[model samples]
Target: MEIKFGDAKYYAYTGTHDPASDLESVVFVHGAAMDHTVWAHQSRYFAYHGYNVFAVDLPAHQFSRGELLLSIERMAAWLNQVIDQTVGTAFHIVGHSMGALIALEAAANFNHPDAGLNSLSLIGFSYPMSVTPQLMDAAQHNPSEAYSMMTQWSHASAIGGEPVPGFWSAGMQLSMMENSTAGSVHTDLIACDNYAGGEAAFVKVTCPILFLSGMRDKMAPAKLAQAEADKNNNAAIVLLPDCGHSIMSESPDGVLNELKRFIGARK
Candidate 1:
């Protein structure tokens, strides 16, 4: 689906389902340098099973056409505008990696007694999410190296084999990053590295929150996610064993099941 905000046009994958007023909404936001396709498995399932799914491509990341928002706060604010224009009634947000940070900020700002933010699911998240200098440098001057490093680190193993037939997890991720808009990876890394409001944002969110961590994650460690979840009274953590930063691809079924149980219970 296409949504216009001013002169810019944004693309959201609706799983081939049209939006309706009666159905609840679930928005999926992907990590840095990634697009709506990262949520392919989870979003399509939710859309097919009676929910309005919006797997969004952040501005300048993929099909979305606009200048890239350079910080987490700006991205969060843009997300709020998207929700206001597209979603009606109760809604839930599912986000991963960098997107998780955006979701946190957005929920803190947008969720209210009558705002209809039913729940929040943060996957591959950590507070004070720092990016290494080496990775940042690579993203700026040697993007292919950055993509290779991220792809290798994102999964438990490069050759461990994916559950889906005829698929290579690491290769697919690398391709996605390679295909992203030029300099977007560095832009996203800077946003994650410089953001200092995560702890404050976590406390502001009042709705139930899910911290979905990958046990073997190298980027945002599970321990960090646990610490943040520990701070929030309404937050819970679920660890995906043998998975890494890319939980959606490495443990698709586990991610989907947890989201179903968490959001379904609230409904």
Candidate 2:
């Protein structure tokens, strides 16, 4: 689906399901240099199972058109605007990696009392997600190398252990990053590296939260995510064994089942 926010057009994959007022809504936000397609496995399931899904492509990424929102705060604010215009009702938000930080900030500062935030699910996330200098440099000057490094590090095994039979998880991830608009990886990495408000935001969020981490994640370690979840009264953490930062690909069923339990319980 397409909507205009100011002069720029924003795009979201709705699993080919048209939203209705009676249906509950859920929005899925992707990690850096990724798009709505990352949520392909989960979004369609939710959409067909009575929820309205908005798997969004952030501005300047994939199908969305606009200058990149250069910081987590700006991305969160823009996300809120998108939510207000699209869902405009009680909803759940699911975010991964860099998108998780955006979801954290948005849920913390959520001002829509009428359109409540039912729940938040953060996957493969960490507070103050630091980007390595080597990765940042590669993203800026040698994007292919950056993609290679990220793809290698994102999964538990570099060879083949994808949840989907015969599907090349690492290849897909690399292709997605390679296809991103120029400078988007560096822009996203800068946003993640510079953001410092996650701890504060976690304290402010009142709704139930799910911290879904991968046990073998080298990018944002599960320990960091657990530490943040520890501070929240209404939060739970689930660690997926033998998985890495790209939990959605390596453990799609695990991710889906946990989300169903978390979001379905609230409903």
Candidate 3:
């Protein structure tokens, strides 16, 4: 169903839970260039288990209101509003790719006074340190070049032990291109490029986090992600063999298993 929050409508698969209960909701955030469709399997699975699921499309992305503003903080702030309106209060955050960055930002700023949060899961992402200045500049000057750079990083292999076509995922890439203004990428590359606290912030993430990565991931590239993991002490980094960067689509089973463990363990 759709929850009208702020200026946009958030698409979620929420379960029946008392609105007054401190019972938290699960909000799934999608990565850059992708919409809420990627989490179709996960949202359906979670809703089956009585968990309130809110799989929302971020502002500036398709199926959502507002212009495509590339600021991560702006997206996070809008997301915060969604949280307040949809299921006021406690929540569990699950972010993939760029959405993982949003989860981090939300966890950093979350101050649910009524009660504490449930847990957080970061999937299909490593760290932002992988992006180089040249890539950042390319995305700003010529988005096609940036799009190419992103294409180069996308993991195209399938989790079902089959090879998936690159064109299958081209729609997401195309969305990025169409949403972008100024004839360049929509977002400010500098935000990702200038993400400070590279090492220390991982420590600040006191919540239990699950870092899902593909063995063949090119974007967060497994090696660089490992380097970043050297900094996160409370995180569990799982590597999927023969898989690419697209963990949700590649290994729905693996993703489901990890999520079940993460959510089940809380009880």
Cα lDDT, all candidates: 0.91, 0.91, 0.65
lDDT of 3 by residue, 61-104 (tens): 55665666555666667676677665534577888877777777
Highest lDDT model number? 2
Candidate 1 local lDDT, 52-156, one digit each (tens)? 989999999899999888999999988888888775468899999999999999998884333488899999998899999999999999999999999988999
Tell me the TM-score of each prediction against the true structure. Answer: 0.97, 0.98, 0.78
Q: What is residue 168's positional error in candidate 3, in angstroms?
A: 4.5
lDDT of 3 at 249: 64
Clashing pairs in 2: none
* Poorest stretch of ten by lDDT in candidate 2: 81-90
Q: 145, model 2: CA deviation in Å?
A: 0.6
State how far residue 124 of model 3 sits from its true place (Å): 2.7
The predicted structure with the larger lDDT, 2 or 3, is: 2
Among residues 3 or more apart in sequence or in different chains, the pairs in candidate 1 whose N, CA or C atoms overlap within 3 Å are none
